[model samples]
Target: MGQFYCLHCDRYFANSTVRDEHFKTKRHKKRMKQMSGPAPHTQLDAELAAGMVGKARAPDCRGTLGAVEGLPFIFLLM
Candidate 1:
């Protein structure tokens, strides 16, 4: 038996047909969109841009996540 691999989805399929079908799935499409560019702007991004949530640090920057006045404290790992 031969296995077809989808690099984007990091999944293996039985054949090309199955792999191609998976590429059309919503999950795969969403992943592709996310990987293609920066994340879509939201309230949090807006606040960060406006300096309302303190300084927006890079993903690799090391710092403490202190309390923000009007925002919930959340931690993200990169």
Candidate 2:
């Protein structure tokens, strides 16, 4: 769970010897190859991509969702 954990393979070994052996396995190699590509998106990533949330929201500018579509200006409130 601590030192001998394989993040890409998501597996654990009893000791370093077994873990080292696991690193030489075809399945582990394949998993490492797959992980070498683009990383998978998380829930926060999905939300940001879909405009559900972001780093910071302006005082008046809201999302073009549910109500606004082609609106030119945003409504400001006091």
lDDT (Cα atoms) of all candidates against the true structure: 0.65, 0.68
Residues 1-78, model 1: lDDT tens digits: 548987767789888998889999999998888778854555755655555764355342223222233445557799
Candidate 2 structure, TM-score to reference:
0.52
Worst 10 residues of 1 by lDDT: 60-69
Off by over 4 Å in 1: 38-78
Candidate 2 lDDT over residue span 1-78, tens digit each: 546888888887778999998889999999889989765655544564577774484334354322333465545898
Best by lDDT: 2
Q: What is the TM-score of each candidate against the true structure?
A: 0.43, 0.52
Clashes of 2: 0
